[model samples]
Target: MSEYIPLKYYFDRDLALHLADLIQSEYPRFTITSFVESVSTGVENKELKARVEVIANTLKQHLPTDYEEALAILLKILGPENKTEEGMFTNGYFLMPVAYFVERYGLDHFDLSLHAMYEITKRHTSEYAIRPYLIANSDRCMTYFQNWIKDPNSHVRRLVSEGTRPRLPWAKKIPPLKNDVQNNLSLLEKLMCDSSRYVQKSVANHINDLTKDNPEAVLTWIQKHISDNHGTNPKIIKHGLRTLIKSKDEHALELSRQVEQGV
Candidate 1:
């Protein structure tokens, strides 16, 4: 069990319940079931996403500054069952509260909430909702990324990339990281060969995002990093080279052609 922290002790339970009720009333169709069904189908609109943001903000007001309690609440709402097929839409609805608390409070603890949040969002199949919190704490976000890279869980490993994606859909871009792409790229390097396909996708997306501003840097890294002994980790390969392929860069094009030939 995780340690206890009085982080959310100051929050008003009534307010938290009120907010959850309001979300249900406002978006009657926004149940855990519906959310799970829609995860792969794509988000309905910004309005709904915004509503989630509203709930998150409300939760923020209630979150205790301590790390453990914050994570306890997040996990409580977004627990293991939500990640299963039986709990499809369950995960999406709970994300609002978890996101709310993380963004509102500071990330000052042993970074416990950071890890738990990453685990919760990892299965969501979309990172847009979590980007706000990630960007808001970008100054300290690197540490979260560094620690997650070596996590035993594949979901946590991918959070390192997905959470920091520059142009993640539904998310506003964070300019400083975009300007100095290396910081993000360097982090992705740790998970380039992650065992999980989900993680590889994130790594590729991170690389793709960097390719727009620094194609040469990405190309050099891929050449130096990709391995022959890794077998067929196409998800990682595709994500790692996504930007180059999209831009029709010379090397990227050649690799695509090779992939097609091999197929």
Candidate 2:
């Protein structure tokens, strides 16, 4: 077999060098030597997210302390928006730490960080980074989400759903989001018929997340959204109710059967 590489290896020394060079290109005064040195120390041993955290933390130390100034520098480094939906991890791998940097430090500045997410998510993903916005200001965050659902960029539209997942993997749970089921469903209603499969998956996953504790509410939603003109709605319900189906839930199985029949 060809030599195997670990997933964590993506955040390796070469990645650090590449990331440092990219930032240095945008902000000439960025100290490349110091940034890379700090990021490379024992980074290989840490797990995936830890590596991202280490780099993000190091960036905070090396860059200006003021959040907006540091964000300005970070923004300059995001070269262009990723037009395709599929290549976020491949084309935008370098931005993992950059997005994390925003998640870790940008929570305090609502509008600034929210705007930063809009810009960065188009290139990479602000999925995990954007959660704090929901936590810190649910109403304000919802206002932003309202606009994001209609956003022309697929990634921005995905963020409106993916970013608000109740128990989004690799990120901490947002209790408010988990508890506020109706508001969450309202947002999902808009995205259920999204053109992008990328957005569709997030919308489905968001609904699936709701089924964990709010199964009845999700069932109610399925009752309302599903019909003969199913479109992708049945698949959305089937995936969302998969957990319940395996447990032999009567209604969930019925819905799965409906999906199979394309009704």
Clashing residue pairs in all predictions, respectively, total 10, 0
What candidate 2 gets wrong by more than 4 Å, as runs, is 1-4, 42-44, 176-178, 227-232, 259-263
Number of clashing residue pairs, candidate 1: 10
Q: Per-model C-alpha lDDT, please?
A: 0.56, 0.84
Q: Judging by TM-score against the true structure, name the best candidate.
A: 2
Q: Candidate 2 overall Cα lDDT vs. reference?
A: 0.84
Q: Each prediction's TM-score against the native? A: 0.63, 0.92
lDDT of 2 by residue, 1-263 (tens): 88877767888778888878877877788888888888889585799999999989988988889999989988988988898887888788889898999888987788888998899899989999988777777889888888989999999999999888888998887764636799899898888888888888888888888888889888877766776354656667677788898789998888788767777
> Best lDDT goes to which candidate?
2
